[model samples]
Target: MGFWDWLTGRDTPPPAPVPEVDPAPTEGDILASLDGVDQLISGGALPAVVRSRAARVTRLVRQTLPRLGSLGLGSYDSYSVVATATDYLPEAIGAYLRLPRDWADSRPVENGKTPLLLLIDQLDLLGATMEKIYDAANSTDAAALITHGKFLQERFGHSPAADLNVPTPPSGNSPDPFDLERP
Candidate 1:
């Protein structure tokens, strides 16, 4: 080492820590995670705002779950639903829950918002996203119903009623209302 470096007591740099990332959850995992989050939300003594928003996210996820097939198994919307359920919503709530209630609700952590406010904003975003995903999933069925109705109308809507000619009794000779003798 140089004299100046030695005098300065320079040392080896510290190693950078790697960020920990959770693996992407599967569809089944996503569903299970939603259930878990539901239990957490219901079981915990969270504020009304937190509980309500959490409910909205879980409800949307459940409503959209069965229709994910219609959205295409691996498509972006499907993936979004899964990620929100398994990652975003859970992580946001979990982080807020980890903090003490008074401090989380009162102390501004970032951008002039308390942890509670931050969490609410995050949950709101998640809820809105899930709402969109729900609508997209349901649109598949709605579109099919519309298409089928259109098909039915095309096949039957414009056809004329069949003409059945009932011969009127010989003009001015009609006698019997119920029955007439036939020659």
Candidate 2:
């Protein structure tokens, strides 16, 4: 509405909006922690089994992070992923790493289970827990897909033959005249 702008019939653009500070850790922040854990674990000289389980848990967390909102903010599942990235997973691995490898691997600290075995158990538990969270987080999308499919089916119509991939003869195709089974 300025005089020059009005005369020119051109409008001035509005100012850019400021981004609000989010309270929750963003994807980047979470990923950074996960990356840190990866570096820590990978840098240490650990057995393949340990590395595998840790990788599994980390992968689960990474996969689950995107759909985390589906699990709800401030929820236990969300917190678990965060904690695994930031604390639980790192701490367990770090504690094992701090101990002398040969001693830790050889000696039985708890009920005849070596530190390596205990670490594997912890990782397995974490991996399972992460899998549960990942499933829960992704269940929303699955539910949505099912709901959408149902809606489409209801709004249109179900095609059992098509759904089952069964084939039908083309229209206007002539049947074998010699066939006695022809209708």
Candidate 3:
């Protein structure tokens, strides 16, 4: 808020209100929340990045429905993951939804990014979480993948190969060198 606006009692617009969530959110509940957010994004003007993330969230919701059906909607684990990933989406979007476009786009907070940019980044993270949930549901050989992942981690998770102390060949001329004739 500028000095004049503050003096005039015109404070900057407050953020959009976040939607409420159920205590134990189900797949349907999660999807409904996503649909609500999608509609909100569509109905109003939004930044390009926000629009893109909103579109992705909608697409993910569409893709998730069938997977949820196949994975067993009653499965607590799947429901938990979906709920965890999507439950906060509306609030994340809402944080900047009601702010004036000029303020959202131009005003920088303590992090040095405008509210619009921060919202985009937050949506990106949530979108990735949703994708991971989909991947977990669709995984064909999760056990195998996990085993391999652990193996790779054990093999390469440490310091560089030089730390292993494998002997290095002498760089300068040596008294005795490998000779094909002797062999």
Q: How many residue pairs collide in each prediction?
A: 0, 0, 0
RMSD of 1: 11.7
Over 4 Å off, model 2 = 1-24, 160-183
Q: How accurate is candidate 3 locally (lDDT)?
A: 0.73
The number of the candidate with the highest lDDT is: 2
Model 2 lDDT per residue over 65-110, tens place: 8887899989988998988888899899989998999999999999
Better of 1 and 2 by TM-score: 2
RMSD of each: 11.7, 13.4, 18.4
Residues 1-183 of candidate 1: C-alpha lDDT, one tens digit per residue = 778877887864668999999776766787799988988899866898899999999999988888888899889998888888887888898888899889999998898999999989998988899888889888878999989888977888653333355564677766667675654
Mark the regions of model 3 whose C-alpha exceeds 4 Å error after superposition: 1-23, 68-81, 84-86, 141-183
Better of 1 and 2 by lDDT: 2
Question: Please, what is the whole-model Cα lDDT of each candidate in the order they appear?
Answer: 0.86, 0.89, 0.73
- lDDT of model 2, residue 165: 75
Model 1 regions lying over 4 Å from their true place: 1-27, 158-183
TM-score, one value per model: 0.69, 0.74, 0.54
Top candidate when judged by TM-score against the true structure: 2
